[model samples]
Target: MAIDQEILEVSSMFRLLMKKASQDWNRGACKMNLTFPQVQILYSLNNRGSLKVSELADALNLTSAAITGLTDKLCSLNYVERERATDDRRVVYVKITKEGIHAIDSVKEIYREMMEKMFNQLSKEDIQHLMRIFAQMLVNIDN
Candidate 1:
């Protein structure tokens, strides 16, 4: 095959992989009864601990109104709580609840299972090589 043809095939395969990965993630999120943004909020808080609403919005790259809607739903689900800052009542902090932690664990388990199934055929070395290639691709894209 020509070099350009090989590159085209590689790019097509990358897109297919990304599409399937996204589908898998959506499926997992659905099983947890959470929308993608809601799950993202749980994941963010789980990883970053409690954060102000504005900080959460920045972390998720969402508008303040969008974050408020997500947080409202999460609060209704008993997955998170909001607290007013002691010195500044205007500042509200969002914190994950015990239920939220459980959801985060479930998400992690779901991802682990998805990864195990997806790469069951690959050896350790193969995985490392793919990671290196992906890192290089990221660098190339950044430049």
Candidate 2:
């Protein structure tokens, strides 16, 4: 195939992959009653511990207002808690609760199932090669 044709095919495949992944993810997330962004916030908090609203917004590439709305819902669900910083009364931090950790564990299982279903046909070596290719693509894009 010509380089242009190859590029078009790759782009098409990438879009299809993303669409399928999103659909699968949505179904899984729906079972847990969480949106993708909500899960992202939970995952971030799980990994990074507590963070300020602005910090979470920056880390997640979302606006502070958006983070606040999401965190509000999360707090209502008892998945996370917002606490005022002791040293700085004006600063608030969001921390994941035990419920949030449980939610993340469930999400991890969903992800594992999704990945297995997606790549079950591929051998271990094939999966490794795919990861390497994706990593290189990311590096190239960064440059």
Task: Point to the candidate with the largest TM-score.
Answer: 1
Q: Compose the digit string of candidate 2's lDDT tens values, residues 39-90.
A: 9999999999999999999999999999999998899989999999999998
TM-score of 2: 0.91
Question: Each prediction's Cα lDDT score?
Answer: 0.93, 0.96
- TM-score versus the correct structure, for each prediction: 0.93, 0.91
- Candidate 1: stretches off by over 4 Å: none
Candidate 1, residue 141: the lDDT equals 96
lDDT of 2: 0.96
User: Residue-wise lDDT of candidate 1 within 37-94, one digit each (tens)?
Assistant: 8988999999999999999999989988899999998999899999999999999999
